[model samples]
Target: MSQHSSVAGASRPVKEAGFFTKIKNVACLKSSSSSDKGKGGKGKSKSLSNKVSHGFHLVEGQSGHKMEDYHVAEYRKRKNHTLGLFAIFDGHLGDRVPTYLKDNLFNNILEEPNFWKDPEAAIRSAYSSTDKFILDNSMQLGPGGSTAVTAIVIDGKDLWVANIGDSRAVVCERGSANQITVDHEPHAERRRIEKQGGFVTTLPGDVPRVNGQLAVARAFGDQSLKAHLSSEPDVRHVPIDSTIDFVILASDGLWKVSC
Candidate 1:
């Protein structure tokens, strides 16, 4: 089955969220009990439980900085357990913030003693703590921020998705698409920003922005705007069984072009 979901452009009236919470949920693209024919050959059959493929590209924006990274890995926690992790980070103003998250965010969540018990709460806490870490290390990370979307697959059966900022995640089941995350746009977040003692503004031909600088209302880093912005992520869990076929995670660039 094939499914497609278009992420909205920045102009869309969607709430913005980021810090891209990384949580644990497991999903498999194919049923483990079935021997499916490989797409690459007529007779080959591959184990769907462990089959994964990924690729990425880098292109410098007009500002001359190239800062986007995606990650997919099987993370081992205990002697007998492992989790599939996927994430995408879109950097603005600098790359340090996203790079730092790509390296540390998941590790922090995995370290939580109760991660497996209450994954939702664990993810929320991890996102907040991760943002605090960014704020505390502003001196080294610089005054920048990133949008993120992450997925954690546990036991290859449950899929947990989370995000902050405009990045997104989608799941395809029975040839239909379902969005699994909410986009945090400035317009939708204005009230929250104001209540937090920060403000949002919309200039000519520009989408609403927090403090008239950053485009996303939620993100990791951006120390200058951290007080008004949020790093909390919207998270969801879906069981990867016979019905669900695949998942998609991408940055605003792809969303803008197609969503």
Candidate 2:
């Protein structure tokens, strides 16, 4: 029951995190608008250094439930540098987990010990620890889980992305688009899931699902299926230059149709 907010048309320093220490007391940042079920919005922002203008749009899906996807599109000042933070969190079963992520995931990543020296390691560790936190508090977070794709642009010089589940990041350069994150579908990692004592099923008319429940093989929360699920994200880093024009970060709803 949290309302969504956006940092569109302007930039702000990453705010002090609104941490969640108590379950029922959690609240998301207040916003004039909300992306409730069947409702969507669009926004655009520009970086201070490179002037990399980034834009995003969310479209309500056909699903007849409250919006489960959460997102962040903002520019932040950190350590005398401007960082562009973009992400999509696709939730299933409930919204608590994604809402938790929309609030804390980036804060957790930037706070990682070696973020400057090794972003990949820092991101990996953060993802693992974040997922652990979600799983450990599943009773309060609910039985739901979410797939996430986060992109961080540092001082307009580098772009680092990490993802779990089917949410993806696509980088555009010289008029061509290239996907930079892997889609963690159930069939691709069946062996690992099987070894963990879980089974994926593909009915005649349905897509493969983990334990006949979730569609993604890796995600945060889903405490009931944690034994077979992986929260380890595929992390990628790239140096940005003149050729790197833009990047798109979106939840699976934007791409699942083609598959």
Candidate 3:
């Protein structure tokens, strides 16, 4: 249980989006035990009691977009107590912004004193605070922007998930897949963007995009669009009792090919 420290904001150079153009295949690692069932199954239990195993892999496509820009962190404080997170961070101009977020965002969320008791509020607070921190420190990070989608697994039974931008997470249950993240396309997020004084555009055969520069209406970094592009993440809670088998968290490139 580490606390998050606020960092000073600064401006830096931006990276190119070419690194994210590659396609990749990812597989979920099977766990040895079912999180839904307990030692004796003696009725409902509370306080994060369960066991689960998780795994994932990534491969880059020929588009020169290396798969390294994405960031993932898994921390288990103790046996059966864990946190798993995934973020796609599509960089329009450079990778510094996404890389910085990958390194700091989750730590900031977990370090909040309220997270243990109220995961949702803590997640929301962290999302906004982190975004502000990024904007405040834009000068240090340089130019560029990144989208984030993160899932926190606690006690193997309770899951707190959040996302800002187009990155996504999906749950697999009973041999079927259900999308848990909402794609914040310009069309879908039009009203929100308009309220924030932003605009959207669409090309033939393509979904609406924000200002024709990005598909997601919100994301981290992109200081130039901060007024319209938000870093607020949509948060959800999933219980272990539900028919949950596994989950997949991916970037746009993977989604482009798979979906």
**Quick one: best TM-score, which candidate?**
2
What Cα-based lDDT does every candidate model obtain?
Answer: 0.63, 0.74, 0.59
lDDT for predicted candidate 3 compared with the true structure: 0.59
TM-score per model over all chains: 0.76, 0.84, 0.75
Tens digit of per-residue lDDT, candidate 3, span 127-172: 8888888788889876667777788877666777788776777765
- Runs in model 2 deviating more than 4 A are 1-38
lDDT of 2 by residue, 1-259 (tens): 1122211122222222221111101112223232232266664445676466655555565556667777777778988988888788888888899999989999999999898889899999999999999988888899999888998989878899999998877765654668899999999999999999999999998889999988889999998999999999999998988676556666766555543
Error of 2 at 105 (Å): 0.4
> How do all the candidates rank in terms of lDDT, highest first?
2, 1, 3
Q: Report the number of the highest-lDDT candidate.
A: 2
lDDT of 2: 0.74
Residues 38-124, candidate 1, lDDT per residue (tens digit)?
A: 121011112234443222222233333343443333344453555766676777776688788878888888777788898888888
For lDDT, candidate 2 versus 3, the one ahead is 2
